[model samples]
Target: MSGPVWAPPEPGAVDVHTHVVPPATSFVERLTATDPRWARLVRRADRDDVADVVVAGRLFRTVRRVAYDLDQRHAEQAARGLAGQVLSAMPELFATWAPAAEAADYCRAFNEWLAEQVVGYDGFYCGLGIVPLQDPAVAPELLAEIGRLGLLGVEIPCATPDAPLHDRRFDEFFTEAERLGLLVFMHSVGSVTEFDHAMAGTGAIFPARIGEALAGLIANGVLARHPGLRLLASHGGGGLPASVARLDFVRGMAPPTRESMPEPAATYARRIWFDPLVFDAAVLCLLIELVGTDRLVLGSDYPFLPVDPAELLRDPRLPDGLVDQVRSENPRRLLADAPGTKHEE
Candidate 1:
């Protein structure tokens, strides 16, 4: 948060958090008859640009063209002075609750389609793939496929259907992710069903789940075990920054926690990246203080909550050069290692 004013780079800021949904024609009929969790888009008769995402015969949520139309997404990014976006599958499509093989097949189709979608956008967009974490045994193969497809990395939910991220089952997957230099974007599905029961709500639960995932990684030594892993916590680390002191406090009193953890929870927290989507300048500043500027990236969660880079610059409490770092430089560093992706020098 403290540094000399940075000379503004060129106009293209990189948004690390955005999502895209594939057209229903791609998979709806193919999977709907057999797959209970298949999500299909139903166009709204009243509006041309919007549609409702339906799953299991239930209304999921509504989305606009920006969620799937690359042309419109590119235009919007240009309007906001952004040069690029890192797109991931909508968490709803994750379908982690399904059987492992079923989930893997669905993920494979989506990953290939998303990777192909990035080709037209080229330098303006990179894509993140998903793996079937329900069966950790299959994760490494899927991750390898993701790498083969030239994806920047994979989007991971806060927890599997029955296991937290820290469970031993995921150690191999994490190991492979580190070896591949893939970015692990840990985003909660915004469902209380994916996290601990105590952390529940419509508005507050999303961040709470993300915080829990971050804490679990640190406390369970996932970060320490795989130091080379590129991890990005969404929603500004989703309460981790605000609650780090409590994590440290607990570690001090619990001898077992200190013995098991390789370093202070806050120390591990700083080593990872976070998206600056806290929605409050003061909170963003605090996250900067906790994680340092190099680890904070711009994440608009585009289409759901499109953010303008100027919104970050408008805040006086933040340092003068932070916009360039969070919106441009840091994100480039995050995606630089991926094949088929572009980055500024």
Candidate 2:
């Protein structure tokens, strides 16, 4: 811990999982005018450097300038020997509970703002915008717009308040995403509109929900239908590693499951990608064993999780060459073919 535990990988590495929030003042007026949901949430603060994020008149989290400051983020990543980061809006911004049109407008504006920020960072950051999945009809058009806006992909909730990732309502969006070869980054929310009131904010819902979403995607044949799609799950795919075997066993006993998946649960699991931000070396090893080395990448839920990423990567228990793969090679390869705006100076 005295010095950098792991040397920066050659050419530096790309962090595929990170988050950002636009300054509330940027859209608070339009949002508060139409959507009380947002009005009660992201009000403007007196200073740009700090703001309290309120939800339903309660403080959610305090955000700071680093959340959107390009120069500071660049220098911070550089200190860790990272060449760039893929920036996505925080999960709360998904706003699946809002009216479809309002959500779409917010997503479009946020994406445009994010794309502009990415361009301003030159090659230091890559943009992963959001789409209004609450309205399946509009989501695909916005997804195509994401590509045009020079963003690498879209970050979506692992499951909407009312629908799972494989719900047929969204098949069109996923279809267009595959056809366009865009990355689909799925993150789990700690609380959503549909969860039981008693279970809200218990903190266990996030990872468990990711596991459920993965199972739904596999069992309902989303991956089978969109073979070319690239999905990167946040938090190392939640509880999938420990439960995959049980899933395989259940699929074997259930004819419907077999009919949909055609392969073992693990087969479909391997087809998806995961970020190694599980916060434990043993868990990281389990994920590698489940999906192999090629599918793993660096994910520091940065600005929230304060641990030094290099220290996490330096664990001796990790397999030889695994550090370099996760820290440097894997993310670069995954993003190398992205159609987003070039980061080259």
- The estimated TM-scores of all candidates read 0.89, 0.88
Which ten-residue region of model 2 has the weakest summed lDDT?
1-10
**Model 2 misplaced regions, further than 4 Å:** 1-10, 33-36, 39-49, 192-202, 341-345
Instruction: Put down candidate 1 lDDT per residue, 215-333, tens digits, no spaces.
Output: 88888888888888888988888778877788788888887877657587778988888887777888888888887889988888887764564487569998888877887788777
Residue-pair clash count for candidate 1: 0
Candidate 2 residue-wise lDDT, 202-285, digit = tens: 356777888889888987888888888888999889888877898788887887888778888888898888888777888888
Model 1 CA lDDT for position 190:
54
* Model 1: CA > 4 A from native: 1-11, 190-202, 306-313, 339-345
